[model samples]
Target: MDVIERFCNIYIDICQISPDDLESIYAKDVVFVDPITTHRGIDAVKHYFSNLLTQAESCKFDIADVFHCDGNNTARTQVTHIVNWTMHLTLKGNNKHITLDGTTQLNVVDDRVAYHKDYYDLGEMVYEHVPILGFVIKKIKGKLAS
Candidate 1:
């Protein structure tokens, strides 16, 4: 399967993803970034995911769309893939689930992801889930929308 296909399969059930699974889709020198932080190298990425998965009661990704930019044969380095997805996450000790929409850009080299960046609303994914913070964030959003 192609890199994007492999990525989708691995992320669809993030809670079950193992270090070996991450290795399959990412290069040894992979750089991964998300709303929270950036991790350089495959080992760092694996460590990040290990902690994240441990804190998550359940996590799932639903792919909404995928756009591929294939650079001309002359510039193999221009190839990039963008994937839009929605994530459903339930943190440990919290029965409530958070659904957040996000997009990921993947730079594939040699059929493995070398650079991965994710864009998502931190307020929706994290801040809004906090007890006092959720109320304040919602109030601020409501005020801003008016």
Candidate 2:
């Protein structure tokens, strides 16, 4: 199969597995970096995912788009994912279904993912869930970034 197909299947597999099943898809030498933390190898990746899933339930990913670039024995994919579900970063409070947009960049080597980078605004996820902090955070962030 082609690299893109392989990568898509990997993502589908991730969706199917429980968060505990991270080791299955991640290579032993995999490098996964995201906005908050950087992980090297499958073990660290597994640990990172463990912390993530602890706060969420019925987690689902909607793949909005996938951009593919192929080279000699290598492929990169830029993926847009829409996440909707419930999460508890603290206090285990109830939250409505939220839609979050994020991107993942994958480096494919020999049909396996060798390196992956995920990009997203964490404040959009965290502060937006609060009542008044949501608006204040957005405004402050906008003003600062500008």
Candidate 3:
């Protein structure tokens, strides 16, 4: 499979992801960025995922679509891909399941991801799940929408 497909498959079920798996798809100098933070290098990315997975009872990604522009497919000299997906997560000690829609941009070099950036709403993924904070945020959103 191509790098984009391989990358999507790896994230399908992150609960079982290993450092080796990450190494296979990511370059040693990979730069990973998400809503929470940014990590540089394969080791840092692995460490970030390790900590994130430990707090989750389960995590899964359902890829909705993928778009890419590569030399073979297009005239573009750069290789970049975008993936849209929905993430389902259940945190440890919390029975409540959270679902969030997100998109990721990936830059590939030598069949390995060199850069990755994820886009998602922090409020929808986190703040909306809190107790009092959730209620207040919802109220504010309702007021803004009206």
Candidate 4:
């Protein structure tokens, strides 16, 4: 399979992220960004994933869709891939599951991801999981929406 397919297939296994695993999927100077963190380089990416793996009992991603440019379908191309996903995680030392729905934009270079950005609501992913902050944030949102 091509790098893009392999990337989509394996990148979701957050529990087993390693440099070796990402070697083919991410460039050496890859840039990864999400709502909470911005990091550069593959090691930084690995560190970020390690932190994520440690926080949750188990984490998994369910991809809803992936859209990429149509071309020669080389290992990497001037393409923007949009992936919709739902991540399931066990947080706070509890067995409860917190699922976050998110979308990621991936830019590939030379068969590896050079730039990756994820879009999701901080409230849905984190703030709502906190106690007092959740309540306050929800109240503020309700007031603003109404």
| lDDT by residue (tens digit), candidate 1, 1-146 | 99889999999989987877899899998888898888999999999989988899999999999999776543322439899999998889867788999999888888899889899999998888888989999999999999
lDDT of 2 by residue, 1-146 (tens): 66555445545424345554554445578788878778898878877766655654434555656776545552333332222222222222464556556777776555556678877778776677689999899889799999
Model 4 pairs in collision: none
User: Which residue ranges in model 2 land beyond 4 Å of their true spot?
Assistant: 1-16, 72-93, 141-146
lDDT of 4 at 120: 92
**Cα TM-score per model:** 0.92, 0.67, 0.91, 0.83
| CA-lDDT, candidates in order | 0.88, 0.60, 0.86, 0.78
| Tens-digit per-residue lDDT, 2-29, candidate 4 | 7678777775766656546877788898
| Model 2's TM-score against the true structure | 0.67
Off by over 4 Å in 3: 70-79
Better of 2 and 3 by lDDT: 3
What is the full ranking by lDDT, best candidate first? 1, 3, 4, 2
Please say which candidate is ahead in lDDT: 1 or 2.
Answer: 1
Q: Rank by TM-score, descending?
A: 1, 3, 4, 2
Superposed by TM-score, candidate 4 places the C-alpha of residue 119 at a distance from the truth, in angstroms, of: 0.6
Error of 4 at 44 (Å): 0.6
Candidate 4 residue spans exceeding 4 A from truth = 16-19, 70-79
lDDT against true structure, model 1 = 0.88
